[model samples]
Every structure is written in structure tokens, then in C-alpha cells.
Target: MSRLTAIIAAVVACLIFCLGWLAMHYHNAASKQQTRAESAEQQVNAAEAVTSNVLTTMTIFNTISEANQHAKEQIALDASGASADIKVAVASDDCALRSVPDGAVKRLQQYADGLRQGAGGSATGKPDS
Candidate 1:
């Protein structure tokens, strides 16, 4: 009976130790998992920030490109009109060379105004030719 009692005590002690060990092992694993999750979340946030910055830059570039295109079109239209006026002046016998100069100047002024507006600047209050 004494030997049996001693054997039982040893078994109970071993069982308690095993349970404690298992609890500590599980706790460590949970902590490691939490750390990994937090790291992944931070990485996701960083990636989102980078994507946002890239989008903003692209938007700005598109706006600038649109402005440049508008300016170019305005300039081209003015040039075409000036050319037509010169052609008409050449065909007319009564039209003086001074008349062609005036028309050309007016068209150049309009082109300058368009460029100013496209550059986000105020126009010089010049009338369109």
C-alpha cells in the first residue's frame, strides 16, 4: 500500500508539470502569432501610403498635361488666323502692309493671353482677335 501511494504521488506530480509546460508553450505561440499579425498590418499600411502618393502625383501630372495641351491649341488657332489674314491682305490691292502688321500683332496678343491663362496666371485683359 505504501509503495502504491508513492507511485500515485509521482504520477500526479508528472501530470501537473506536463499541464504547466503545455500552457506555457501555447502562450508563447499565441504571442508570436500576434507579433506577426501586427507586422503584417504595418506593412499593409505602408503599401497603402505609397499607393496614395503615386496616385496624387499622377493626378498632378495629368492636370499639367491638360493645361499644356490647351495652351498649344490656343496658340495654333491664333497662328492659323494670322496666316489667313496675311493671305487675304496679299490678295487685296487696296490693303496696305500696315494692315497685315496690325492683324498679326492682335493675334499674337491673344496667343499670349491664352498661354498666361493656361499657366494658372491672370490674363493681361487683351481682347481676342
Candidate 2:
């Protein structure tokens, strides 16, 4: 009877050890999965921020293009009957001190000339004359 009781005790100990090992493996797998999910979320956030910045820059560029077109139309109308020298001097802005502003002024002048030369004020860089 004592030998039978010892055999039963040994079987119970083996089952308890197996259960503990299985629990540890399950915990490790769950931790790895959580880390991967967090990394993916961070990448998605970074992509969204970049897209938002690009959109803002494009909006500002479009606004500048429209303003340039409007300036060209008004200058041409004001200088329609004036001499060539007077037309060249029109739309001269005092705040233009940089190279970029110089380029903008040059672009406006070309547009104004196109409008007066019977091309109808277009700034699409196509030859109107």
C-alpha cells in the first residue's frame, strides 16, 4: 500500500512542473506580440505628420501663384496707354530687396507685357506674342 501511494505522489509532481513551464512560454509569446504592435503604431504616426507638412507647403505655393497673376493684370491695365519706360517702371515694389523678389518682379513684368501685346494676361510660361 505504501509503494502505491508513493507512485501517485510522483505522478502529481510531474504534472505540476509541466503546467509551470507551459505558463512561462505563453507569457513570453504575448510580450513579443505587444512590442511589434507598438512599433507599427509609431511608424503610422510618423507618416501622417510628413503628409500634413507637404500639404501645407503646397497650399502656400498656390496662394502665391494666384497673387502674382492678379498683380500682373492690374499693372497692365494701369500702364495701357503709357510709354515703354513708364510701363517698365510700373509695379516696382520697394520691399523687393532679395533675389527671389527680383525673380518674382521679372515674372510679373513678362505677364504684363503678354496682356498688353494682345495675349490676354496669362502666366503659364507659354509664349503669348
Candidate 3:
């Protein structure tokens, strides 16, 4: 071959090799970016699932707390009504009033007060807003 043609042919081969190398580099970079995007998407999905589970757990706790408060209110009411009935019955019987000590009644009242406080209710046995 002539000298000029040989030089031109060598330049063309070099150009083809450089283009192949560039294409391979670009493909590798794109694959790495796709992998990163997939990992980020998985992390986001996991976060969403955790948030939903926490919300559900909080809802259940609230439901249980409200039920407990309602039961406490009912118990307080029943206790007070029974106290009034007992007082009336005891007042009518002199012997029974002498048998029931005053300390026992005070202890019972203290127990009811603790129940109201624990149930988030007022001293009047009403649930707090």
C-alpha cells in the first residue's frame, strides 16, 4: 500500500476501537444507575410499609384505651349506686351499721379514686375530653 493510505487506514482502526470502548463505558454507567434506582425504590416501599403498620398499631391502642375508659366509667357508676343502696339499707338496720367499720368505707372510696385517675376520668367519674 502507499504510505498515505496506510496511515489513513491505521487512524480509521484506532477510531473504531475508541468508539467501541466508549460504548462499553456508557453501558456500564447506565447499568449502575438502574441498579441504584431499583435499590432506592425498594427502600421507599419498605418505609411505606413500616409507616402503615405503625398507624394500624396506634389505631388499635386508641381503640383499647377508649374501651377501657368506658368500662371504668360503668364500674364507677355501679359502685356509686351500690354504695347508696348499702347506705340506705345500713341506716335502716342499726346492727349492720355497727358491724361495718368506717375504715372499710374509706378504703373503698380511695380505691375508686385510683380507678378514676387511671382511666383518665375526672374525680366526678366522668371521662376526660
Off by over 4 Å in 3: 89-91, 94-96, 101-129
Give the winner by TM-score: 2 or 3: 3
- Which lDDT value does model 1 have at 104? 76
lDDT on C-alpha atoms for all candidate structures = 0.86, 0.80, 0.87
What lDDT does model 2 reach?
0.80
**Residue 102, candidate 2: C-alpha displacement in angstroms:** 28
Per-residue lDDT of model 2, residues 15-117, tens digit only: 8999988999998999999999999999999999999999999999999999999999887876674666664665485644435678678878888777668
What's the ranking of the predictions by TM-score, best on top?
A: 3, 1, 2
What tens digits encode model 1's per-residue C-alpha lDDT throughout 7-120?
Answer: 999999999999999999999999999999999999999999999999999999999999999999998999999999988878766555455578778877767777767743
Question: In order, what is each prediction's RMSD in angstroms?
Answer: 5.7, 13.2, 8.8
Which ten residues in a row are the worst by lDDT in model 3?
A: 119-128
Cα lDDT tens digits for candidate 3, 1-129:
699999999999999999999999999999999999999999999999999999999999999999999999998999899999998888878687565579777766766787757744444556446
